[model samples]
Every structure is written in structure tokens, then in C-alpha cells.
Target: MMKLYKKYQSLIKISFFIIIFLISNNCNSQNKYEILKSKIENISQNSTDNSKSSIEIIEFLSYMCHHCTAIENILNQWQSSIPADVILIKIPICSNKKSEVLQKLYLTINEINKPYLHCELFHMFAKEKKSITHIKDLNDWLISKNINVKEFLELYNSFYIQSKSNRANQLAKLCRIKGIPTFVVGGKYTTSPAIAGDEYECTINTINYLIEKIRKE
Candidate 1:
């Protein structure tokens, strides 16, 4: 009887340690993603005015930016699976001449259903080193893909696309955007790979954490 009681006590102690170990491991895993209040900041009201929805995410990026290209790749895999209530908007950083045209291209391309071309364009600029600095270059590139260059140009230069690009640029100013691939969540909080480190998944997880935080509010 004494031997059996001692064995039982030993088992109980082992089980307690196992439970403690599991809890500690779970906590560590959760801590891998964190929300840095210092990193997340609010933009100007004028920039956030149109974001009437409960949750709005604006990604400030430039086509020529390599980090933006990396974020774009990550987004392609994650975007389709995002929550329905969350709205994601891509705004180009028009800090340069090339960015101006690229932003317009983004707006124009978004109007169409060619989702594949989105990342392909990024690849062309980043990996292929293709300098699409003008409307004519963009037109020729579209032609090769069997897309109508005339229609694309008309839309690219249209009043509607221009208005969107103008609004995006204005909003970017509110976010105090000094870099590409910055993500503004709920038009108030911003995060990026720079803040979250090189882990793209962690960057997204941080965004998800913000989404949940906003939902609670």
C-alpha cells in the first residue's frame, strides 16, 4: 500500500509539470505575435472619412519598392481568405514620377477582373527590372498579355481612376507615410514589416490582432 501511494503521488506530480509545460508553450506561441501601440498610429480625419465601414485597411505602397513587392506576394495568398467585413484598399505612394503612373495603373487594373496580373506586374517591375515609366510602356505590356491596350489606357487616364489616385495620395499624407508597404488598419492603426521584423506572417498576424481589437471596440 505504501509503494502504491508513492507511485500515485509521482504520477500526479508528473501530470502537473506536463500541464504547466503545455501552458507555457501555448503562451510563448501567442506572444510570437504582438501589437505594438507605438508602431500603430492614427492618420488625419480627412484620410479616414471615406472609411465608413467598421473595419477598413489601407496599404500604402509603391510599385518600385521591393518590400512592397514582398508584401504583395504575401497578400496574394492571404487576401482571398480574409474576413468579409474587412475592406482592403491598395493605395500607391506617389512620391515620384514613376509612382504616379504606377498608382494610376493599380486603380485602373483593379477595375478589371484580372487578378493574376496584379502580382505579375509587380514581378515585372521588381524581378524583371522592367522600367514601366510611362503610359506607352504600360500599354505595350498589356498588349502582350492579350489585354486591350486602348481600353486600358482610356481607363487608366480616366477621370474616375484619377480621382481614386488623388484621394489615395491625400490619405497617404495623413498616415505620415515615409515608406512603402505600410498597412493602416481601421484607418487608425498602422503596421509594417519594419515594425514587425522580417516575418511577413507575423506582420499579418499583428494586423489580424488589430482587426480583433477593433471588432471588440
Candidate 2:
């Protein structure tokens, strides 16, 4: 009888430890991101669409902002592994003439189906320290890239590109985006590296956490 009681006690002790371990692990998993509530703000309290399952993550950025250039690699890597339900939209903030030109340039490249040039343009400004202050400067750079300068110039000056650039500017204003590299998740919550104590990883974690939060809702 004593032997049976000892075995029963041992099993109970083992089960208790297992339960404790699981509870600890669950708590850790819930708080793994250490997301700071202050780092994110609610932009919209409106109800999200129940019919659409996908989420849109809009990134407001500008080529003139070095901070935006710095996070491109990490952002691109994260983009590559994103789930199919998430969509990343990059919008250039046109706060001035130079930025307006860059915004048009981005639209022209997309219209021409040469989206790869987007990274090349960033490399030119970030690494080469090049500036396209005038149409001539942009033409010269396009020529060096072996792109059809005449074709690019035509599209760059087209009304379609102008309209797209204008829309981007308006969207930035609507979002009240005051800084580059600002991320708006699901068009409702806004966060950034600056908001997350200038920590890129924290910003990413915040983004992922928000994504899951929206999914659950």
C-alpha cells in the first residue's frame, strides 16, 4: 500500500511541474515581443471590413530621408517572408520639389514595369551621394543606367505619373505622416522605428504583433 501511494505521489509531483512549465511558457510566448503600447497609436477606430481578409501595411517613405534608406534591406527581408494575406504598399512622401520629382520617378519606373530600378535609385542616393536636382541630372543618371532616356523622359513627364505623385502626397497628408519610415498597419495603427525607441527590430516586432492583433480581431 505504501509503494502504491509513493508512486501516486511521484506522478502528481511530475504532473504539477509539467503544468507549471506550460503556464510559464505560455506567459512568455504572450509577451515575447515586449511591445510597448506607447510605441503604437490608434489612427482609426472605425470597424475594419469583415469581407476582406487581407491586410494592407502602408509605408510612408522618401528617398531624401537617409533613415528610410538605412532600413531598406531589413524591410525588404521582412517583406519577402510575409504571409500572403499581407500587402506592403510603399508611398513616397513629396514634401518638396526634389521629393516630388523622386515620387514621379518612382511612378514612371512602375509604369514601365521596371520595378527593380527602385533599389538602384536608392543606391545612387544613399551610396553614391548623388542628387537629381533637375531634369538634366535625372536624364544623365538614366543614361548611365543604360535605360532608354527618351522613353523614360516621356513617361516621367506624363500626366499619369503626375497624378500618381499627387495622390501619394495627398495620402501622406491624410495619414498626417510627419516622418519617413512610418508604418501604418491595416490602415488603422501607426508605428515606426522612431516611435519604438529608434530600434528597427522593435519596430518590426511591433508590426508583426499588430498584424496578429488585427487578424485576431
Best by lDDT: 2
Model 2 gets an lDDT of 0.77
Off by over 4 Å in 2: 1-51
What is the C-alpha lDDT profile of model 1 across 57-88, one tens digit per residue?
Answer: 77888778888888787786777888766767
Candidate 2: C-alpha RMSD after superposition: 10.2
lDDT of 2 at 43: 28
Tens digits of per-residue lDDT, candidate 2, 48-115, equal 53214567788888777887888888999999999977877788878778788888887788778887
Q: Write down the TM-score of every candidate.
A: 0.73, 0.75
- In candidate 1, which residue ranges exceed 4 Å CA deviation? 1-53
User: For each candidate, what is the lDDT?
Assistant: 0.75, 0.77
